[model samples]
Target: VSPKGARAASAGMFITLAAHVAAMAPGTNIGAAHPVSVGIAKMDKVMGDKVVNDMAAYARSLALERGRNADWAERAVRQSVSIHAAEAHRLKVVDLLAEDLPELLQKVHNLPVKLNKQTVILKTQGVPVHIMEEGLRTRILKHIADPNIAFILMLIGLAGLYFELAHPGVVLPGVVGALSLLLAFYAFQTLPVNFVGLLLIILAFVFFILEIYVTSYGLLTLGGVISLLMGSLMLYRTGDPGMAVAWSVLIPAVLIITLFFVGIGVLILHSQMRRSMSGVSGLIGERGEAYTDLNPEGKVFVHGEYWQAVSEEPVAKGEQVEVLKVEGLKIFVRKAS
Candidate 1:
């Protein structure tokens, strides 16, 4: 049964036809039972025909058993045809049409349903309908089970981990990353995950990280992008659209994640290559004023503090000197030219 403005398409078509009394609400549509290929490799013409024929036969069998339109069922599977509620009733694709659930119940009250060993008549009239709501845990599991949600969670986990690794002191990112990864793994247990695709995604992250150390001139980043795209395409091994990540989700996710990894890598590399601004190394090449007269060694003020300084030549009092190097508590200096 399909609700108003809803459709019984693809796998839903098969289920609808198998019902003892198939039905559609006003403004609803049905048909389009074409089987989608979930294989990583493209099917050849002959193999494609075989799959279509097989699916068509199954659809035809279901329609015949339910005393529906077998020819329309076959056409639905083979040609991906669809029909509105009124047209479906005219074509015998559906047994009845109703405005709502109550009307449907009223219509199917005395409808005959064939059983394995007997014929049964429905007693739906005046049957009070009680809708059961999903529990919190069930709702959470349902959201998590979605391929798009799982994929996003996995990406978030990777991004968090990447941030944590790049800057180790950040505790929040690591914690978030670990939790997201756990959830993603839990989802994977129920999802149809392709291990090869998983490996490719991991490899993509590796490539992005390598960009920071190895100077590949964007080659590594490009490879990472390619790997990510391919992995996204092959992630879920299922023909069901609900089980697969939508292209809308995939495109944005890939672009955003790729930029994120590469951007982080660039920031890290820049920080590593930049000159130090603190400690002894920072004092080198700094000019300081002589605080005391120096025959060969004296005190000099540098970076707002006094330091022991040594000069190869004699320097007078109140002279400015340039620090060349720092060793322990002493700084090698030369008179400012």
Candidate 2:
């Protein structure tokens, strides 16, 4: 068992407990049941004591059941203790310690093992080894557990929802957003996500939307960006590098989203400030000549075409008029000074 890489908490503790005649290679490790590994290293005194006591009892019981060193197991849970393979074997925490598998098999050959009230002899003459192939579902689930993939899912979900909200009645964005959010949440179930961080991210989106209606200048947007960055930083503050959101993903994502939010807000604001150039708006400020007496309602030639023009004061034919507004096809105008 090369436990050389990292494994801890529930998976590590439970799997180690189930091992029979467990062996460890050099530079390998086992036995980590600390509650602090659950991302609450700074838990308060009373609660921390209770968690430690409970985990210690649980680990000790598992050790006793497996006929392993119960004292060391309790220490593993309470004090977050670890030891090298040589020490582990010397302490009988593991049955054997060897440099590699061949050495381990040779050392353990014919070693007596107690099997439920009977001693068993090892049959290690020439055991054929068949490696188990990873199933497709397991492989896919493994990939889904990646923090980078989860982060990408979150971004995709947010972008889709943003598009859907900005352009309502577009079914694609809403559908993609819903699915991506669900998948992201599924991934989050496996990840050590800080709820406050998740909430801050949501708040950032809220602020981004508020920039459109609330006239806080760009302050709300700046705050939103800050919230996003802080939220991302706290998203996986659990100390474990395996569970952390990558800085590479974080920086680029923040920049892209900041630009996206600001760009969208600017376009909308610009459109609102610019003169209307379509529909009834297109006729506003257009200069035209009255073709007939606008006894408040008559035809006027504007933009090289005739339009039904209306004015409060009477205007003579061939008089220059400026369009003030448009109601349906009727052009409201005033006589030019």
Candidate 3:
């Protein structure tokens, strides 16, 4: 053991101490509970002192309750004390120091245990201890707690919904989006998420929509990209590395999502730039024949139909012409070259 002891979470320490109280035996050992050993930093002076004092009291109570060494427990918190199992047995913290659980159980057979309001005796000469595999739900929950998986699920949900919006009436996208979102929300509930970060991500989507409606010269899209990047960076604020969304996942996701918006924007712009493909406006470049003479006003045959016509130049009857433009049942024409 290092002279510098290890840290532990205070709440977990207290709970384990209670478990120690229930399972007290001459062979069992109760070690120190020092948060510093596990890398918990000392907080603000006021909060720090209170935390230490409270932890000390809880450990002290558990020690005394089990008739172990309370003084050593307090020293573990206040002075960062630690002791080996043999040393703990000498200090009345443990008894029957066998290396294996079976050996320990054999030695502690017929020993008395104090339950909340009952006394129990151990009897294990031939009894077997069964170990069960984790259930399906437990496995699922474990995977869902992973930040990378959660982040991926959220991206899938957002993409699915965007595709659904772009190509409406597609049942598959909506169904996939709804399922992915439900799973993502479940994962988020278990993760340490910052709501402000989440809101920024949603705001990014709003900016993306504005890029379609408001012509801000791509300013809105730039803002959306910045917001998305910031949000991805701030998604999980916990200091634990395992709880954080990995840079590998964050960087690629941000890039891909930005590309998604950019692609959508380009498609929208292309659609707007295209010439009209339906209705009377679709006849802008059709060749036709003058049905009657026009002193710049006459009828013309176009697209296999005769219709009202006007021209910038005069046309003799039956002269060939080309449509200059279509204006609400009127075809403006010019003499075909």
Among these predicted structures, which one has the highest lDDT?
A: 1
Whole-model lDDT for model 2 versus the true structure? 0.79
Off by over 4 Å in 1: 9-14, 26-65, 68-93, 114-127, 167-171, 189-196, 242-244, 303-307, 327-329
Which stretches in model 3 have alpha-carbon errors above 4 Å?
1-130, 162-168, 239-241, 289-298, 314-320
List clashing residue pairs in candidate 1: none
Q: What 10-residue stretch in candidate 2 is worst by lDDT?
A: 33-42
Candidate closer to the true structure by TM-score (higher is better), 2 or 3: 2
Worst 10 residues of 3 by lDDT: 1-10
Each prediction's TM-score versus the true structure: 0.75, 0.78, 0.65
Per-candidate Cα lDDT values, in order, are 0.86, 0.79, 0.72
Error of 1 at 151 (Å): 1.5
Model 2 pairs whose backbones collide: none
Number of the top candidate by TM-score?
2
Q: How do the residues 1-337 of candidate 2 rate in per-residue lDDT, one tens digit apiece?
A: 5746533344575567657667777776666556643321345689878978987888788778778888998888776677777777787777777666677778878988777888898877577757699999999877876877877778778878989988999989989988888878888877777777888888998899899878998999999999999988877646343577788889999899889889989998998899876666777997889999999899999988899889999998999999998887788999987
Model 3 TM-score on a 0 to 1 scale: 0.65
lDDT of 3 at 108: 68
Worst 10 residues of 1 by lDDT: 35-44
